[model samples]
Target: MANSTTAQALQNITGTIALVGAGKMGGALLTGWLDGGLDAKRVVVIEPAPSAEISALAAEGVALNPRQAATVDTLVIAVKPQSFRDTGAVVKPLVGASALVVSIMAGTTIASVREVFGGAVVRAMPNTPAAIGRGITVAVADDNVSAAQRATADALLRATGSVEWVDDEGLMDAVTAVSGSGPAYIFLLAEELARAGVAAGLPEALSAKLARETVAGAGELLHRSELPASTLRQNVTSPGGTTAAALAVLMGENGLQQIMTRAIAAATARSKELAK
Candidate 1:
């Protein structure tokens, strides 16, 4: 969980909040808000088919799509890119001119959001780890966004995890390729590591246990350490050690670096394509 600073920052959203999607990321943000002491009565979620978690939230006093549309102080849109075209108009009327509009949809630019729903538009990229309050989000705000509104958006995003503000929205695609999609990449690595361990004669269960723990432990170490990742990697490698032997193959010319670069590039291109 993020500290009280984030919770305190969220207090500025004292009016009404309208969240347009109650799926994973949206649900995670909503959960974080409620856990942080935001008044449940002040929030309204616009979900077509409510999940059990959403039903529970509604029971807790967070409004689940009241019939009459009311103006909100903050409008948060977390719908899929394709669904935006169909749902955007319905949500536009719910926002007041002074309200803050933050979109967590990937590949949806601030200009695009502003075109559909006019307000202080912010574009954010948040990863799935947000469900557990460990995600990292990068956000960019349009010129229409005020300093106060930007801070409000920052507070909302930080409820889920760390928040980074970027001056250039164009860099969001790179952010998407790295952090937004990076968790899946790490999970794939863990899977392959376990398989390789099994191939080396270790039992399947033992291999899986070793792989999961190694990756989890390394991530925790990295999180706690002030040292750069490269420095930490060097610290783990002894002269002619097993780690060094593994690094030789991984650091080879046509190796992890090249593979990662190509992967990010492909992801960035697809993100650009989606914007079109």
Candidate 2:
């Protein structure tokens, strides 16, 4: 689920936009849509058990489980993969033939969505950092999606952070392995760094503070800089310098790149299995 919002995708969502889930990612996206000028009245959330946040949103004029299957312009499937068995039967008939089907659930393939819903479909993967509007989403859409529909999808995804599009649905598994699961790696880095610092005699609080801020600051720099990550790394490493010494180990034969490659491969394999 996305943590926050940024870009505005739709000026005015023109019809009843049914959201099948209102958990974190779904809620984050709906918040973005409402904030971006999609009329609150135009939305219908279908969470059987609404969270307090979702319940609060209902007061703003959005419909919560109207109990009848009405044709909607778009049906966004953000519910968990395990719950799709129940939800698909309930949602499939409610969207019109011309409706756009956007699914952000991991491991749920476009083919699966089309088979069940049979409409123009866009499948996307978004990370948890989206809760703060700093996540990245990778999306792939079917050939039938109109330019307008694609734009709408892009706007919706971009509310979290940046968005990337890929033509090959095959790559989405790797995308999921990478960006979808990438945040934990950065977090782990900060965690291990702090642990290492503590091991080197620094106080635990100081070590954690330094590691956290240093990681965050470096990320901000990378975000603001035009230079590639390699270039930035090179700039920080002087000959035989402390940074270079650290890099020597990090970029070693048994270092981050190798470990990351294995981690991503395992994740990709699991994603494919889940697709089945």
RMSD of each: 1.1, 2.5
The sequence of per-residue lDDT tens digits that candidate 2 reaches over residues 1-276 is 222333334653466788888899998888877766677888899998888988998789889975643788788888998787678888887877779999998999998888887789999999988787778899999999999888878877786678999999999999999998899999999999999999999999999999999999999999999999999989988998999898889899989899989999999999999993
Distance from true location, Cα of 181 in model 2, Å: 0.7
Q: Distance from true position, residue 139, model 1, in Å?
A: 0.4
Off by over 4 Å in 1: none
Give the alpha-carbon lDDT of every model.
Answer: 0.90, 0.85
**What is the lDDT, from 0 to 100, of the residue 240 in candidate 1?**
100
For model 2, what is the C-alpha lDDT against the true structure?
0.85
TM-score of 2: 0.93
Model 1 TM-score (2 dp): 0.97
| TM-scores of all predicted structures | 0.97, 0.93
Minimum summed lDDT over a 10-residue window in model 1 is located at 64-73
